[model samples]
Target: MRHSFYCFALFSLLGAAALLGQDKTPPAKLVLKAKTGNVTYDHAAHAKREKNACPVCHPKLFTQDAKAPVAFKPPHKKHEDAKASCGSCHRAGGTAFETKGNCTNSKCHVKATERKG
Candidate 1:
């Protein structure tokens, strides 16, 4: 019984850890699928980026087909040139509020050879 109790405690701790680390970021499926490059943009993590503001940048690069208010539409979209879309600004990178790397030189962008990987 003690072993079972320990297991439950361990799981609870892990659960809490996951929640703490979880990117509060909502689903970015719309923008994710629309991207043209192999770049993986973590919207949640990005939101946490200090100087980055979603409203300030998103609409300029992306377009709404329905002509409805963004609040009335889902946060993401599907199937389009993501780079030519939202990626345009993000491609250049931005100032970090709580993280590292310049917005333009960010890992998501960086001229091919400039990438850290």
Candidate 2:
């Protein structure tokens, strides 16, 4: 009984420490797909770009669910003006570069072909 009590106490302390060590940031990366190619958005880089402003995207541009279904339709103009849409900022002189600027640039995106081969 004494051994079991000690084990329980040790586990409790370990769990608490583990929780405390966790970061408050949601995640540093997310994979977004488009008809042209797949791109991994680096939240860490964007956080720096936005000067660590979470409100730039939270609850407005994106929900808490990182795995939410984001349909990237073509005829791209259709989505250019949609509320909180990626293109809203991905366009020229917004915040980030245009999506079609270059598929090889590592700053914004990496093509699936490049990611694999």
RMSD for each of the candidates: 13.1, 6.2
TM-score of each: 0.28, 0.59
Q: Mind giving the per-residue lDDT tens digits that candidate 1 earns over 73-105? A: 122122121433443333334232211243244
Cα lDDT, all candidates: 0.43, 0.69
Q: Positional deviation of 114 in candidate 1, in angstroms?
A: 24
Worst 10 residues of 2 by lDDT: 75-84
Candidate 2: tens digits of C-alpha lDDT, residues 1-117: 999999999999999999999776677889887655567877788778889888887767677677886544564455555633676686555566665655557754455553655
**Candidate 1 accuracy as lDDT:** 0.43
TM-score of 2: 0.59
